[model samples]
Target: MEITFKANKNINQEQLLKLYNDVEWYAYTNDMPQLQQALLQSLDVISAWDQEVLVGLIRVVGDGLTIVYVQDILVLNAYQNRGIASQLMEQMMTKYTHVRQKVLLTEEAPDVRHFYEKNDFESCDKGSLVAFAKFG
Candidate 1:
């Protein structure tokens, strides 16, 4: 039940990529190029493991000193509701609070919204600022 934070450059990309696919929040089913880009953008990431088994992960994409968007905060299905995500967010906050531009996007579901709130996020009103995405 130990959480370990490591820079993406220091870890095995293949294992970390596998963890990314294992998350439920992964929307694209077959987009290797995009996935690689996503991995490259993550300045800070962590893998939660019980010994050698990877159970959860958190990734942040942005310039480490400024805008960090927390993405793919996930824990295995069996590991849900156990404060694992909370702990991951807590770790991120502790490490990057001074960045002053921390943000995360959640799916359009009540449960997802609740999860974000519990981790100290609130709904923002960005009038006329549309958020866009593409799935391949």
Candidate 2:
């Protein structure tokens, strides 16, 4: 499949919902309006498309100079293992090459950890730093 990537593209609610639901991300799919608004307000968003279908996406939120937080990176189930996520990440990294800190928090899964590590992101515990978060 010839996948195309777009930055800060105009995405409708139906497209977002379908992509999120394809990956079983119920939390986002459960609140369509909030998810749509969040994407709209994010600092940057890179999306992968197969023709007109939204197959993958990566979203970042931060000041763009000192730090950038990778808030989300996901590809549809069928689209996984095909380098779509990596391409999306590469675009984000290339866009913020000058940023000192690029951070992301994700579930403690082996594949997830491997993906980030392969993309040159070291875990907080592996370095001389630590991370903390409190979800409401």
Candidate 3:
């Protein structure tokens, strides 16, 4: 499968909803307008497409200099295990190599941890850093 990557915020609501829903991310799919607005205002967005089908996406939000927070990285269930997410991460990392800090929060899972670790991200617990988050 030839997957093409694009760095742009021109994705339609249907594509966003389908991609998120495929990954069971109902939290984002629940509010279409909010999600769309969030992506539109993101620092950067990289998407993978199989021809015309949206298969994967990775988006970050930050000031683009001191810090960058990877707000979301997801791939369609059928498209997992194919290195699409890794490619997205590689592109994002390359784009922000000058940034001092790169941060992301994800569910606590062994596979998830492995994926991030493979991508060169260290867990806060393993280092001298600590992370805190409060959800509204």
Q: Identify the candidate with maximal TM-score.
A: 3
lDDT at 57 for candidate 1?
A: 74
For model 3, the superposed segments whose C-alpha errors exceed 4 Å read none
lDDT of 2 by residue, 11-71 (tens): 9889898889887889998999899889989999999999998999999999999999999
User: What lDDT tens digits, residue by residue, belong to model 3 across residues 10-76?
Assistant: 7989999999999899999999999999999999999999999999999999999999999999999
Which lDDT tens digits does candidate 1 get at residues 1-136? Answer: 6645444424455655566567644453366566656666678776677676666777888887988888768777677788877887888778888897888766676488778867777766444434666757
RMSD of each: 3.6, 1.0, 0.7
TM-score for candidate 1, residues paired by index: 0.73
Best by lDDT: 3
lDDT of model number 1: 0.70
Structural similarity to truth (TM-score) of each candidate: 0.73, 0.96, 0.98
Report clash pairs, candidate 1: none
Winner on TM-score (1 vs 3): 3
